[model samples]
Target: MRLRNKPWAKEEMSKYPHIVIPNPKECKGNWNKVFGNNQPIYVEVGTGKGQFLSGMGKLYPNINFIGIEKYDSVLVTALERIKETKQENVKFLNEDVENLLEFFADNEIERLFINFTDPWPKKRHEKRRLTSEGFLRLYEQVLKPGGDIHFKTDNQGLFEYSLHSFSKYGMILNNVSLDLHQSDIEGNVMTEYEEKFSKKNMRIYRCEAVYRD
Candidate 1:
């Protein structure tokens, strides 16, 4: 994705100190302390423009939601949304998921959401896929034992690849849905991309994967 450079993006993000955590690396394992609560912590990798995370913070006030987006330009949009809503339980991280350990300790996160992450379809780029074993290993290190991953994607090739990857990595899959919009599940929050694709009559695949001892 070619990110448009927003010269004032970083400056704008700094204005929302409550939403955009300052020096997130310092919070590290002490995330509960950052939120001032022991409630479960949930993070959305590749949060995009923050539609999902923002809605989740409102839906589950008890759960702390962090939006991780590598590009400042894209993240600033999320921060602005949070700023407008004045949502207290949400935070934003402008960094790559590869360095997740640098800001969070083992068992620090209770749940993770990978919503419409890039497919990275090339065979040589398999490792770049978030559901790949390489990324799953990283998730295992930071997520608490038995922590779950809620993943949704519209790409069939990526969805199939993720199912096999999760199975190979020994993750227990549940709530599998080949066409989420047609499913009977309740409380399904739609992302910007999800709304756009669903309008096109696209099938949205979704599942939950858990780490078991």
Candidate 2:
């Protein structure tokens, strides 16, 4: 769903400062302090509409969840969902994933989630894919040793590309599913895209990639 430009997105975001970290860099290595507790942190890159992260936050209050969306318009929608749910453990970041290192310290994140990200299908734009080696290296820098990335997508090309990419990086892969809905994967939190695609009988691929540095 292509979102239209919202001239009021930035202003609307200011209304929810508590749910959106005002100065993310200040929290950096001290992310635990942002939530006022030292709980495991989980982050979702390209958190489209906050369904997954907000659900996870509400379900697992012990873990802190942050949703990163680059566009202010898209992020405001996520923030709206968070607001409606009144989810305290979840926060939204209006920033790019490329600058992930600038927000969190080394080994700061426990788990990373990438769901239905842009495939960047063209060969010329391979590097723009979130699962590209460059992003994986960046993920490694922030993820704790043994921490893994959980990815799901309806794009077969992206999933295949990611599988090879993870293997190329020597990441241990497990629980790969070609059709996630048919699998008996319990505790699955549905993202907006997941719900939309699954209803259309579209196959959803998922996998876990552990970076054992």
lDDT of 1: 0.91
User: What's the true lDDT of residue 8 in model 1?
Assistant: 99
Name the TM-score of candidate 2: 0.98
lDDT of 2: 0.92
lDDT of 2 by residue, 1-213 (tens): 688999998898988888877778888899888888999999999998788998899889999999998888888888888889888789988889999999999999999999999999999999999999999999999999999999999999999999999999999999999999999888999999899998899999999999986
List ranges where model 1 is wrong by over 4 Å.
none
The residue-by-residue lDDT of candidate 1 on 41-79, one tens digit each, is 999999999999989989999999998899899999888
Q: Where is the poorest 10-residue window by lDDT in model 2?
A: 18-27
| Poorly placed runs, candidate 2 (over 4 Å) | none
